[model samples]
Target: METDGNGSMEESRSKLLLYLKLAFLAMEPSNCLLSLAIEAGGGCITQQVQNFIVKECFAKNMKETTMNNQAYIKGILKKVIANVESSSVCAEDCLYEELAHYLTIGGPPEENNIIYREISFLSSDLDGKDCSNSVNLVAALRCSSNMLEGDTGCSLWPSSLFLSEVILSHPEMFSNKSCFEVGSGVGLVGIALSHVGASKVTLTDGDMSSLANMKANLELNKLCLDVASDPMHPCAQKVECRHLAWELASKAELQDQRPDIVLGADIIYNPECIPDLVRVFSILLDNDSFGEDKREAPSAYIATVIRNLDTFNYFLTVAGKSMLSVVDVTAKTQVPNLLPYMRSYDRSSVHLLRVSLLSE
Candidate 1:
């Protein structure tokens, strides 16, 4: 992540505070948060950090959060006190009291597992511009606790996070361009595209439940949902979300969308879906004009993590057979790491693939 390393001490502390608060809101592990606190305290968890936690982070979260994820917060408070005690420093009394309150609140863990994650993309050091008023873009989303349960699309993926950084870092690439996304999980990339001022965005997913959740997340980010079925009474929203099964996607349905740019995050993992995916891409990236001269084919940028070599190669082979060219642009692309506060996300592990038609 591109951090403000050369900034003044005050700026560094401000970043620490922001990072800590964002980590807490993101439900980061307590140990990860403690490390940030210790750095802010210059080797110890100071009384000032304690007060900030109690007054701003814990207090505000407790009061405003409607989710039943207090268990996570309770764990954080416990770890904070432990850290302070280990360092031979006395923690603020209010911190202990906050822990006590969480002790009293009890409920079924399963019922209140759903939560809204505030994904913030800090821009202070993104482009070397330090404007306090112009903070990062925070996209609030309602996500399920069990990401791998019935609906995996409801969960956030690291590739999406990486892709988000790419979109925010290089807004020029997406701004004023017609963008479409495949497997729009949690609708994070779509939100990033809209933030970058994409002229038109069309997001599609195969799963019905995920499609519903994607719409909700888009609305949560203040972007209205536009369905492709209704063209006459279109809303003011520039972003559109639709359900599209790759295996069932017809050529006509695919031809209707001729975006300047196509995007996907973590959509190439499944080996079973590669064929249909390549088919969809082939149709989408094929020549859109009927004239003798062929216009520029729409390009597709796909972000993925190379988990298994076999699966990755399978996707590449399938794309090659479908007359598509895929370039490994992970090192070539310059995407500023806007989400440094999110310690859980490993930006390096994510790779970028620049894909487009290789001439019919």
Candidate 2:
């Protein structure tokens, strides 16, 4: 009985450690982290658990995301230490030392606030033995410190990450096709599209700051944007960045850009923007509007996290009224979770919708 109990305790510890690792990777909520720490400590944080939290979780986050919340992190550490001491468990020395260092030296400089993240996609050979080979895409993104300061468009959202995975997993779908992305925040999806050899890629955002940042990121990856030109012609440039506000975009302009595939990530939040967004989609998907040749209609892949039921339903209703068909193709078009290491990202929360024009 003693041996069995020890084995059970060891199993629980192992599971808790795994949970902590995942929570750190996914950048989960602070409350979730606190709960994980308590659970890992078996209701009372021990010296070893505190050491792990400081070394593995906190240190790793600081390095990866340039997280400079010294005060917030220090508070969490103090709470944990207090809990451990109150429970008569010893706390780790290194945890207190790190906290003291933060309280003294302060957080990272405001200028160096941006974080550079490396997203890797593992590739396997036919034998499936050499699965270690992977492709890495690096993105320079601003932290979500201030959503009101146009930071919302500069931050990398989870839906964008999921959409990037989809593009990489099924390169054939995008390769040799003309692709255009709406609300191209941080330009990760655009980068992925270019990686898969999309014939022509155009990334557009309503926010000028986001457009500028997106252009910088594309250049950082050694990709050049084509000279700004008429939207009617197929982009001769490898990648193009355009400032396009859906509310102000004209129907003629949207119809002029004959793209094979339209893409968007996390752009369906506001109810007020639904009508304009659907109008843009309708014009883009109507291939017949281009000429009498009657080419195959273009399809759109929109990756969204439905936070509000009413807003999502409103989008569906508006889209349907605009003669657009929206289908949930998430299961049918499932892609490999190439980013298994990204625990902070809840892949299950993202839903993929395929949108096209209804047969007329």
Candidate 3:
């Protein structure tokens, strides 16, 4: 097909605009459009059109763009948002924290803050060796807090790094396994399981407030999901949420289900709750034959970025014989060093450990 000069110029603009829209859509779309607006290169387009759409969307009290239309609308708006990275405005801690802030159903940013998380994975498709992908997920537990009140600073803590490093190192351990994550603050690892096609994923946290926030973020990202039955709806994954407390760890059986894999992130931070967290993992792992997919020999993968060796040792000591092996997961690339954002007392202080379970 031959095109005239005007057609060629229009096509060029279309192509450039297409990339811009894709970038904005990639930013979480279900929540609010403030991030989307920031993503769409806010003032680039005919300012009148931008103002018209924003005003209309608000005038109608439309909270978010639907899942089915999100990518499409974003694609159309590409001309507006030219820079993909800018569309992903929520990159640094401030913006990242803001995205998380809206995803959380309730709670203040002071308690539920976002933190930089590092994760590495062993790719079977890549010849069974480890590859690393660093992304952020939410975490409820803090390294220095027992006060579990309405604190937004507690949104997504740095502890998410520990969880990500573990999953990245031992991706297979989670594959085809029924996984249940306790205290799933931001659910980074739990969502990661669904990404790898795990048998099932259930994210639980004691804090109802955090759980609500986690669910919002999960739905917002479409991370761990199943399809919506309605044709009018988009496909989502299946990730369940539950309220659980470590003090009641022994009551895990009460849920009437046992998970093949039990995971936690930054759950060992509070020294006072160390025993409870250990107890929770123990109960979740004790019955190997409980879940539907009872394998010949069941295993587990625990990832942690511990700043305090004493605390790490404490978790290991409390876990006792359950800790079969430990491998330190190192970053494959230095381009995105996690330490800068982690701000650990010692740069090497944040250790990513993979603790395997004893075969049962």
TM-score of each: 0.90, 0.71, 0.50
Candidates in order have lDDT scores of 0.81, 0.77, 0.48
Candidate 1 has a TM-score of 0.90
Q: Give a tens-digit lDDT track for model 1, residues 29-74.
A: 7888998888877678899989888776865564435345677788
* Model 1 lDDT at residue 121: 83
Which regions of candidate 2 deviate over 4 angstroms? 1-113, 124-132, 148-150, 226-236, 292-294
Worst 10 residues of 1 by lDDT: 227-236
Q: To one decimal, what is the Cα RMSD in angstroms of model 1 from the true structure? A: 3.5
lDDT digits (tens) for residues 127-224 of candidate 3: 12221222233222221122355533234444454455445445676777777876777666665677666777888888776777677666655553
Considering only N, C-alpha and C atoms within 3 Å, which residue pairs clash in candidate 1?
A: none
Off by over 4 Å in 1: 1-7, 62-66, 106-109, 124-131, 226-235, 289-295
lDDT of 2 by residue, 35-110 (tens): 7777777776777788888777677654435345454567677777777778787777887897787678646677
Candidate 2 backbone collisions, by pair: 26-343, 26-344
RMSD (CA, Å), candidate 2 to true, equals: 6.2
